[model samples]
Target: MAAAKEGRKAPSRKSAAEEQLPGIEDARTAFAPALSGALERPRSMLRALRFRPPQLLHLEGGEAADRVALALWWAALLNCDDPEVMEPRASAMGPCLSCSSCLRLGVNMHPDLILLDGREGSIKIDDVRGLRSILGEKPHFSRWRVIIAAEAQALGIEAANSLLKVLEDPCPDTCFVFTAPQRERLLPTLVSRGWVVTLPWPEAGRPLAEELRPWEQALGRFVSEGRGWLDMTAARNGMDAAKAHQILLIGQKALADCLAGREGGMLAAVFRRMPAQALMQVDELFVECQDQLQAQVSPLLVLDSMAARLHILARR
Candidate 1:
């Protein structure tokens, strides 16, 4: 299930197209050479879609949301019953997003679209165990099965090895797509199995408070003041930790960028107001909170603890 149904009501949803990063529009141009060669052969359109591209496709760069949106778009394209709506609409149409098949993809409920996320920031061995059985069956609706691993770098040692086994002997009708901050961060074994496409984060330059959602800006203020504002309301509002995690990572990166004398991202000023030691401690605490949540800690309790911890971190 997507974050919404996981009882962690996500703050907002960014559809695949809405999440496109800087170079997404020029997508085919980047893959033009390979696409040209692939199209040179006069194969049936269905055959081309199902069996043409390499089974493994890695989407590199951009924020996690951007990558996810891209992955979803790719998955939708692969399974769209009507290929006429694709790339070259006149030549190859993209998915009619309104169709039943496409709708399922939008909702993250397509039987053939398997979404594997790192529950607590790590993709453990058990997470990969079910892939085998899921792949064993034929796709329930679409012509091809698509498996998207949102944060491929989060795969643990054993999980990566397990994934490698399947890659070594992949199911013919399935496509494996991975999204990550950097391709180099992935296991070499995984990297060697596929080509990579890099998507840099969208050009970022905004005040930290402005970069975040209005609520996040408010949260930042509360954090800066060593106050508790997100204790109960976040859960009531269905906040998704993944989104928070992204912000935390961005904030940390901003701090690093500031340190290196580079123009930092939106949250740079926020970090500027924070002490280095306190920021480090807060970062570590967030990781711990995520891990505990994965370990079945009560959501309310976990959040309360986070609020208390943030208050202390801010005080320092």
Candidate 2:
């Protein structure tokens, strides 16, 4: 969901019987009144409210552009007990509200919906270790557990590998909902373990901006031409996706440094601490890099090509 608008009033909870009487049965009746308060009052009232359960909805965007609308439709069901489906309105932004709204909505302190982010913009191995520490404990509040990773592709190799273990063998109550512009950019092993859903682009027409033209053109061709690497790389940049492919090249070089025992401080550390499976993936990266070089593909383009081929190669 897009970030919340600044200065919006907090949701109210004057009618939140859930706060007055906390229980599953009461919680069901309270949603309507609380929803009314949400519409009537400022956003702050939600914090005064009580607990709510966690819900995970995986949505994918197709070329049609209405994915955001479709996802929001599903989000409405999160608060409601009814199983009936409802049409989504474009106005409701999925949980991307300000911290203030989160507080008001009884959602700010959800132990189940854990929000994980990188300490310094890059997810490190420590991040995964931190999650591992909490893996076994039952959720303190919500029924379902969710882990949202923004910029999921920025996960460092060690971090990603560590997460793979959990993904392969998730706790019974856990649900992971990851968002990325292009799923193909993610590690194939990781992608394969989860339900892959696409969010179609918005249905509304977009004006062709000058800066976006190149990206639009490139993406269009990549998709139509089955240029997997080019498409994946261009999408990663939130534009052309070339940056991830470029970073993969850097990873390849780093792996070569490790295999050769060049004795660099960082390389030596990676060789020491990285798990065997992760090391093997790094080794495979070099082989792919060699192939990319032979094809005269730039380092920045190697990531997509490798990711694309992995669909076939990954099976082996």
Best by lDDT: 1
Q: Model 2, 129-198: lDDT tens per residue?
A: 8887676875443333456554455566677788887766546445555544456545678776665455
| Candidate 2: Cα lDDT at 113 | 49
Clashes of each: 7, 30
lDDT of each: 0.59, 0.42
Model 1 local distance difference test score = 0.59
lDDT of 1 by residue, 183-240 (tens): 7657788988976766654454443444455444445556566444564345455544
Error of 2 at 112 (Å): 1.9
Worst 10 residues of 2 by lDDT: 41-50
Model 2 RMSD vs true structure: 17.3
Off by over 4 Å in 2: 1-108, 118-120, 202-316
Model 2 scores a C-alpha lDDT of 0.42
TM-scores of the candidates in the order shown: 0.57, 0.39
